[model samples]
Target: MGKSKEKRLCKQVKHDVLEEDLDGYKKLVVNPTHLCVKCGRVCNDPGLLCEPEPID
Candidate 1:
């Protein structure tokens, strides 16, 4: 079986933040518009999340 191709926002945050990629992380979070229903993470791009819903 093949693994899923999508990379969720929560995973990105863990990777970018832990790796000290503040700039990359900032671009993802700046002026956030969507919330990840599954992980409760927020990001500007809904496509980055596993289950994204509009934030307000």
Candidate 2:
């Protein structure tokens, strides 16, 4: 089994996620019921924290 990376608390990592940067995340963008697949951090209170940069 592969080892999982440790997750940083949202408060610890500085993010600059924009509203436009969350289209693929769908409702999860605003309603994160799970941790970010990449960052392993829970979604922000508003639930828009995405680890992957948004696609154009």
User: Number of clashes in every candidate structure?
Assistant: 0, 0
TM-score, structure 2 vs. true = 0.26
Error of 1 at 33 (Å): 0.5
State each model's C-alpha RMSD to the native: 4.9, 11.7
> Roughly what TM-score does model 1 have, to 2 decimal places?
0.72
Instruction: Find the 10 residues in a row with the least total lDDT in model 2.
Output: 3-12
Model 2 stretches with alpha carbons more than 4 Å out: 1-12, 15-32, 44-47, 51-56
Candidate 2 Cα deviation (angstroms), residue 9: 9.3
Candidate 1 wrong stretches, greater than 4 Å: 1-5
Q: Which pairs of residues collide in model 2?
A: none
lDDT (CA) for every model shown? 0.79, 0.41
Candidate 1 per-residue C-alpha lDDT over 1-29 given as tens digits, one digit per residue, 9 for 90 to 100: 33334766688666656476677667888
Q: Give the per-residue lDDT digits (tens) of candidate 2, residues 1-56.
A: 33223423342355332343345224333544556557665543323444533322
Error of 2 at 41 (Å): 0.4
Colliding pairs, model 1: none
